[model samples]
Target: MTTLPASAHWQPALGGDGFVEGIDDIRQAIAIILRTPVGSDPLRPDFGSRVWQYLDWPIDRARPHVVRETVEAIRRWEPRVKVTRVVVALDAEAALKITAYFRLASSGPEISAEVRPK
Candidate 1:
């Protein structure tokens, strides 16, 4: 996986959607990732009850397939245009970096990319 520079960022343009569209996309991506033979296993080592309870509602309601499709679409778009690496800041102090690599096929215009979190 390529290493993203610490300063990279991804800001989606979804005006006034209040994250609804973003969440939907995330759901599709998750679904596709989960369905892939190599990445399909669900995350384990469950969090403690308190933490789990805090996230239970959203986790229970998430649509995996939708998330998967959304991610697939993004990956497909990667090389067609250009995408910056994503950098996420946590706790107002630390940052998580991610990078994507692309591959193209002659038969199709679509590009495939894999984003790896670092």
Candidate 2:
């Protein structure tokens, strides 16, 4: 694992309708990650990761706005990182899932996160 330099602030470009909701969720997720304990037997590193993991695809499919919001939120939260991949499927069901890898400069190692629609 690598450690990235702390960001000065989050910066994201979001579409109009889903912007607020997405930003809020991203903020919440970041807070959760910040609060995670770093130890030998620590809990999940971040609540955002858990939230993403258990997100309901159907709901996101039904409401595409939510997925847009999430993407924007992530972009803003971590502007320095670049998205390595993205997957969107509408045929399976009313749901959306996004998995991303990122590279950061000025750090010990690269950091990445998978953001899923909830």
Best by lDDT: 2
Tens-place lDDT digits, model 1, residues 1-118 = 5343333322232334222222233333423332244323455322111111112234324334323333443445322332222221222323221222222322333333332222
TM-score of each: 0.19, 0.31
**Candidate 2: regions farther than 4 A off:** 1-67, 88-98, 105-112, 115-118
Global lDDT of each candidate: 0.30, 0.40
Candidate RMSDs in order? 15.6, 13.9
Query: Candidate 2's residue-wise lDDT over 33-68, tens digit each?
Result: 322322322553322222343245465453454444
Candidate 2 residue-wise lDDT at 101 = 41
- Give, for candidate 1, the lowest lDDT window spanning 10 residues: 46-55
